[model samples]
Target: MKRPIILLMGTMIFGILLSVLISVLFYGKNEVSNSIDAGTKKIVQKEDKDPYEKVDKTSPTISVYNSSTNKIEEMDIETFLYGVLSAEMSSDFSEEALKAQAVAARTYIIYKKENNMTKGHKGADICTDSNHCQAYFSYNELKKNKGEDWIKESYPKIKKAVDDTKGHILTYDEKAILPLYFSTSSGKTENCEEVFSSQYPYLKSVSSPYEEQSPRYYTETKISKYKFVNALNKSYSNISLSVDNLINQINVLERTNAGSVKTIQIGDKKLSGRNIRTLFGLNSSNFDIGFENDTVVFKVKGYGHGVGMSQWGAEGMAQKNYKYYDILCHYYTGIEIKDIY
Candidate 1:
């Protein structure tokens, strides 16, 4: 009887141990699997020599790559990230919450290219808003979620990623955007399956935000020749640079009203959107049609989506001597900042 009891007990112990081992193995696999999705998993599970881990041998070049008197000047990843942070933290963000906006922006930009896209460099092309590919706009209006630590850590992780990409971001000359990816309120970036996905929490009352909504006006002013080159690379005749042609371009943009319509009405002539942007300098998302009083009555606030990486906020932090990592930490949360370069 004693021998039989001992054998049964031993069997039970072995079974329990086997179960625990299986559970541990599964837990680790899940941890890694949870990091990315089916597609992203493939990207993460590649050989070290994977050029995608560093820089791709293939990358698209700028349109004006050949027709250039000056070599395309590359910007530092730090500078780009700094710009993103500074813009996102603008104080004019009265319509939306600032912190969440910054996080979403960082999330979008940082996670857009995982494993190694962007040659390990992260950034987006020149856009008034950070909505080219990475991270769409967001508004955390449903309920104020609590994840301060998570929120705080986003910035640093992003900074570390940018640091890793510094060598690449500083060298790639074309419109080297930080191939970041993002999602609308869809729980995923692929499709906006629901109405309240938070991508456009700004449009609370409206569904399918295809409606045209923005103020429009015109103005006339002369801008420096170099200014036009930096702002928009309109094919300028290597032969001649006419300021009037610049004005005409603005008129065309305003008439189309595709992205923006900033025109200057000088006497009887109307300037173009590009021209007015160049002249009046439409730096932020919204522009001033005209000043109302002591206050600039222009529709504006929180640079970018009001969703991520506030440039003004960053500048404010930088003024306080906040290290880049510290600044990133303040915005993002729950992510380890690994220098994979």
Candidate 2:
């Protein structure tokens, strides 16, 4: 009876061993998987931390002179930025590009305010006239121009871009620089002295390889020789112009490093390229003139002043997956992006 008892104990021990093996085979994998998942979760949480979490969400208030209404409207800087971004950049552009514009626009306004550059805007910090300051449009104007569907679909995207980089501005040497930006470039940006006559180290000429998508990248404006001469004579009242000898008389006196016309001579009057561009309604200072029959063809390259950031080039970089900071750094050399609030 004792021998039988021993054999029974041994049989029970074997069954227990078999049960342990099965449990190990099935349950061990799930334990290891759970351990790996927990490790991955920790890494993802750390990586997804917001860098600007401590920044104040409350934007500073600014007085904006609405040129159309001719009234001073006091609103938060972000609210002002909405109108500026809507008028300055197209909503169809990449989010990164829009973010870049927001930062530049903010920097520009801050620079103006800090330096007391409010001489032109009466008591306001800035004006909405695109010719004077930056272009701007109210929400109602946007709805009128872009329609209700666009406001519902695309307007929120612009607001999001502005919010993502709130209170952020570009700076050089810890001071806000005059962050000038333009619509397009003539293959490269111009130096500060070349265009604005004031030299800023950060606003150096840089190669802009991505503005081919701009509609104004290459534009040809055809004007009658008679009209062209009259326009030039209107600006320089003493200059004599003959339509027959217009091409021969017109000579590019100087060109900037980026190939923009620095100084151009038409007849006896020497005019800066910026003056000629404004006087003749040319899209950019970088232009070539030629006669096609009785018409004078002005082949303009790019648009705007061709200084600081190139908006179309920023969009091109954004298309290649560049971030907003990357676009700003590429255009405005040696600048730091920091919170102004």
Best by lDDT: 2
What are the runs in model 2 whose C-alpha is more than 4 Å off?
A: 1-54
Q: Per-residue lDDT for 49-120 in model 2, tens only?
A: 224333766788999888898899898889999999999999999998999999999898999888878876
Model 2 scores what on Cα lDDT?
0.84
Model-by-model lDDT, in order? 0.32, 0.84
lDDT of 1 by residue, 33-144 (tens): 2112222111122111212235334322211111112222344324444335334443332212232233334334434333233321223222223333321111121113
TM, every model: 0.27, 0.81
> What would you estimate as the lDDT of candidate 1?
0.32
Residue 320 Cα positional deviation in candidate 1, in Å, after optimal superposition: 22
- The weakest ten consecutive residues by lDDT in model 2 span 38-47
